[model samples]
Target: MASREFLKILSSARLGDVSAQQKLADAYLTGAYKTPIQPANALIWLEKSYFSITNQALEGASSGSTQISELIAQTANIPLAETFGSPAFGFGWNSFWGLAQSSIESDSRSAAQWQLVNLLINPINQDIQKQLSEWIKKNATSLEKVSDLDLGALQKLAKQFLNELSESNSSFATNAKELLIKLQPKNEALSSLWKVWQEDQNEEALTQAAELGLTAAKLILGLRLAQLDGNTETKSNASLKKAAYWLELAAKDGDRDAWYALGEIYRRPQFSGYNAAESDRCFDRAADLGHAQAQLRKGASLWRKREKTEEKIRGLQASYWVWQAHQQGIAEAKELLNKILDSCPDPKKNDWYELAQFAEQALNHHAEHKLDEDWLLLSHRIIIANQFNFSKAELLLCEVGQLQHEHCVAVDIRWELPKILPRLIQIESIQQRRALLAAGKVFAAADLEIEGNLRQRRYRFDQVTSWLVTTFFKDQTESAIN
Candidate 1:
């Protein structure tokens, strides 16, 4: 059943009220007032509203012109996937144009005229097509002059606009040049090159695309170059260098596979420029970007072989990365994560009450100087400690971001207190997760200088804890007695 408001709008729309028609269209578009979101119905009412508005404009009064135009733009911009649904559906633009042609008066085609002006002239819609429209509007002459403007490969809206423009303007040629000098990487030539490479196994086309600065092409080219010299024992330094150059280019563009491939290239012992540290860094980058193999590799590297206590510490730190890989369906990661968790099973939950209270007082006291005074970090550590049950040593030494995991938090304080073992703490509640998220925010914003070395952190913790206990707690106790 329609709401009273919707019924009223629908009744007014039936009576040829333009504003009511637009409101009815909006109600259908967004399912407002319990109306079903039917794109086909929405377009129907929008067409009715357009015809009514154009009729009114012809009669020398236009009230809802801007509102209707903006609504049409919004509807036009909706993804075609969402627009095409059951009870009578077509492309949004097609339906819009089809109904628009109903007006007998050529000048009364204001809504259709507005759409073309918006698409070709003002270009208000902020999407890929709009961007292409802006480029085409400015480069109309240039587009006509260009030799290979892959019109077919252009986005649907852009292709339609170009075709219409060419039909309307006698000077505008169908054959045109490249229009993607500004759009980089996602051009017609790159798409064509990719298609040719995939179908014909043309390395030359692949090379051309790579030279055109496509990150995917660069990564593929690098991998192919490296594959040709599969055995590192016989691989020439020149071949490895060539592959590394392209991989490095792609890695700089934040391609995960490129980073992982670069890591592998660096790990090859026979490579002239082999660097274990650089290899680890590349793997770390790839792991950070959610690459499964890199995550597993990084996790395995973090897990140190040692005494049971040290193993727990290392395991906690390694578990997060391993678990990440496991979530991505890596069998080896699942096994490794399970083994680590088995060794460093969740300890009995113990929170620091006095420390938590002291942190709160210190936080309020140094509210203005949280970042510069390091009170914010102390507060974050206290929150982490209370929720994850971190030891004082762990709280002082652990890096906040590294320990954060989806299911649990990792705790490793061996950097400052080698005797104190690392531990994995399970996050068992929504409250704990929220606390971790909030604390993580503080650590993310804190400066490296303020976070300090383990020694400085321990010293600050000692100083602050001692001062808060002596002064703040004594004052509170005295007040309570009074």
Candidate 2:
């Protein structure tokens, strides 16, 4: 749902309010809540904006006429090619031609309009270019004998030629539409600039292409500008600002590299706009987009939160991100992941409480007390421990069967012992895999109290062990329980 403010602005725009229309156009370009970025819709509103202004200016001299004229002049000041480009008006060649044909009567900015049309429609048609240029030149000149060119006749011929093209729209319009659809965003202006830059590494062409709303050009231009060093602090700051501007534009277009670059800029202490929060957000966006460096950074940052008691749960999260980065071929991530794994207690080195003596006695005790869920759970745990070689801590604290991956089991005892990080143990044999599957079924139906705090679980284990040793293992029971 849109807010009341947006609704009011929308109402005003629909009622032909130029300011409101321009605002809506910018909103569509940049995107806002309930309005995703739509370049085509932005262009349509911008076109309607100028058209409304033009109409107002033509109506008569009024208090708003001066303001309207100023806006028209400002729009007119932009180079015709750029004005029609996707970055400016988001108009395709067909759209521009349609505008030119419809606006012939007003003739407010006919020369520029026709010039853009000529440039966009048929750059290969030299005859049309030469004719339009000569015709425009003659019309702009007011001399009685302007270099032997008849201004009125040339104007008539130009209008007649434009009318003829407009009449032949079926052939040209359909072709232009098809081509535009094929060339996404349909801005030939930027495509030409790409060639211009590639020819001589022209920065000017790159800048133009960036201005024409090419995401790649914006990213390249932003990166090039970001690398620049100025003679003074002021100049350096200015350069950073320019780089940020272009990078932000690209970031808004969902460029991951641009987002990462913006993150670096915001994180820089030397940059005046240094903002740690904003930098974190930018890096988060980049990481979400699968930027390897950002993922590594995010993982390392998460790992740093382990000191906080509440952040222990994030240890697995940190490992997950680091693992993601490692899979993406980041060398540092592999080292960090190794370090995290090394911090975990190896189950093989852990104390063994469910040994053969204890296990056989526990099985006999469980058989005698078949209705006891605790004994049943303990039996399942013993079976798991003997088969998979899990330690007493893992057998007691681990979420059996549920934590099984395809080829490995995730033994997480963090719920009882937050210090003992989770580790994945591989299922090396068919026997081990079957044991795990069987354990999963038994545990799934077991009592929830089977998984309790360290103290409660340790007490339960000791109580069961004491009872089993005394009743089933009388010979060993003579030796006091350890």
Candidate 3:
């Protein structure tokens, strides 16, 4: 059931009507109906009209179809590719220009068009390193011209070229300084552009920026490489070496961010060979440089070491470092301070609670980038405590088949028992256990040899438990949960 308005638009579009075609394109581009329409479909309709108008101009060359060509030129700036490329498939360039022209008649596509033009021109035609150096020298006085051009367009082209440059060990490093110097004045804008460029995986820009001694770029590239190291099954010494090299350079330059990054690398046991001593040193250095996060890390490391050694002097030292970090506005430090103070052997528990409340206020004062590891530790502690008290563990198991804490899922059963039997035994409620047993029976209908104790009863549960444990609980064994 097409609406009258839709039918009218479709009828006009079918009669080779440019206006009707554009209107239909607008509908698809805007997703005027509910649930936002597909951008590819929008582009198809828009491109059809665009091509038709262009072909008409080309065919009617003897009669100077200026209007048709003008229309085609106007439509060329639509970001059809950008829209179609998005996961949601929303309209981009097509809607921006069409809507703007229909309402305000403003030409928003000029910048994008200019950028496309520049890309086609390929200002630096030779090797990027050589070309960039020459361009910088030639245009040093005319640097403002680069800024004056469509920045958005130039940024897109830069990203594309930078990606190409990153693929090979080209002259990017040699000319990186010159290019950065040319762009240094526009640091804020360039940084924003860099964020967008990085999303496109423009490694060349990242490499160039790193070579130009951009600490932020160096840190970002290092993090990206570290992320890749995790995704790939094998270790990448090259990635770590590259990250370490840039971080060391940045640290030497007295960049606090670099120091923090170095601390992070050293802190990660798997990545930095579990060099806690070296990690402590890096954190100390970063903390001295007024890095709050490094201070927090240093405090946490000290606290962890104190826990391992059970030395009262080390405990006091950990508390002092944590308090110092807390004063510097580190949220994790405040949290650690609260936990330490709560466990202190003070006669007045109320006073410790009051101090913890104050620490909570301080904790809320700081911003956190990721989930704190303390939460997992605390959850594991709670779970272990519950397991020690069998009644509480049974209560928890009665409510849920598995107790899901931040650290791991606790299935109520002894560790030595075969995997499946414990899960079946954990369901304390008779009805739920019956349902689960019945469900299990569907698979075990043929083999009905229900056997001996919990260990023997786990024969069927073993297969299911093996899969579950391997899939979800494999990494969880690292946590010291009794």
List TM-score per model, in order: 0.39, 0.43, 0.28
Predicted candidate 3 versus true structure: per-residue lDDT over 14-127, tens digit per residue = 777777777676666544422145555555655566656667767763433655444545444444333433422222333332332332223333333332323333344324
RMSD of each: 17.5, 23.9, 24.1
Candidate 2 ranges beyond 4 A from true positions: 1-187, 195-200, 228-238, 342-389, 401-442, 445-482
lDDT values for all models: 0.65, 0.62, 0.47
lDDT of 1 by residue, 17-135 (tens): 87788778777876666688776687777767777877777788856577555555545533333333323223354434432344443322333433433433332343534344454
RMSD (CA, Å), candidate 2 to true, equals 23.9
Worst lDDT run of 10 residues, candidate 3, spans: 420-429
Sort by lDDT, best first.
Answer: 1, 2, 3
Clashing residue pairs in all predictions, respectively, total 4, 0, 2
After the best TM-score superposition of candidate 1, give how far the Cα of residue 309 lies from its true spot, in angstroms: 14
TM-score for candidate 1, residues paired by index = 0.39
Model 3: CA > 4 A from native: 1-199, 228-238, 267-276, 304-317, 324-335, 342-482
Clashing pairs in 3: 79-93, 420-461
Task: Show the colliding residue pairs in model 1.
Answer: 146-176, 146-177, 147-177, 313-422
